[model samples]
Target: MSTSWRIRIMLTIHAKLVEAMLAQAHKDHPFEICGVIAGPEKSNLPLRLIPMRNAAQSETFFKFDPQEQLQVWREMEARGEEPIVIYHSHTHTPAYPSRTDVQYASQPQSHYVIVPTDPAYGEEIRSFRILDGMVTEERIRMINSYKAEWELSMEAMVA
Candidate 1:
């Protein structure tokens, strides 16, 4: 496997996970929510949800609770997993990344998922690959199950 990340211009994630994240975002309402969907390290698959507390607790921004983040990261490491998707909600803002988000993005390989609690957009969830300050929007193929998604990906790889 290549040590360097292979960035995808598009991705497929479970609609269930998307629904869960959107619910979390709505629950957090005016406050931004954040989390990670982790999978086997280097799998390029986001297989589970790990909703995180926004330490900032601001409507306009989000910051992971330092302790929670530390614990989560360690747990994923122990499970031989890495964050395949790093996600956050934007309350009262567009689903696009903010200037600060662009500056703070540290995961070039992980899909940066955004859930906007803007009722105007009906809480549409979007994904992007944010690398070196450049944010490239990605296609999100919502699937019913991760297994189905994984099998398709494997077939694509084989083809």
Candidate 2:
């Protein structure tokens, strides 16, 4: 097994909202769902929980709204957060990145958090760094001074 590395990620978490998102996702069942993760960053590290919005439902995948996302990034920069990462969940799959996932990633510096909500491994969360189609898991460590989301960010549980 590969040991994890701690990423000094600046986290932006909303207490009630994150819980609500997870609950809604758990209720959706089977089909994959998606959402947006926004926050502030310092030296490229994230530090705030701006907001998470639902992705449009699709047949085999969930697609995020690029325009809206850009708007969010712009707003984050306006407030000093900037686009640090993009997060989503895997309804019935492992937390590892799939080939399809590798082909679609656009943010090389940002962390990719995958939530495996499989009934057998529902509590497992995983984090990764995908760059130029190569994927490597990154360890997520909770900082003593930081506040975690009421639930998890798909990254925290796996770490």
Best by TM-score: 1
**Candidate 1: regions farther than 4 A off:** 1-7, 152-159
Query: 1-159 in candidate 2: lDDT tens per residue?
Result: 211222333333333434544565666655555554545443334455444444656424556677767777678778766555556667766768878778888877677766666767566556687889888887654343333342233344355
TM-score of each: 0.88, 0.67
Model 1, 3-44: lDDT tens digits are 222225577788788999989998988899999999877667
Q: Rate the local accuracy (lDDT) of all candidates.
A: 0.85, 0.57
The parts of candidate 2 lying over 4 Å away from their true place are 1-21, 50-56, 147-159
Tally clashing residue pairs in candidate 1.
Answer: 0
- Candidate 2 — number of clashing residue pairs? 7
Give per-residue lDDT, candidate 1, residue 76. 96
lDDT of 1: 0.85
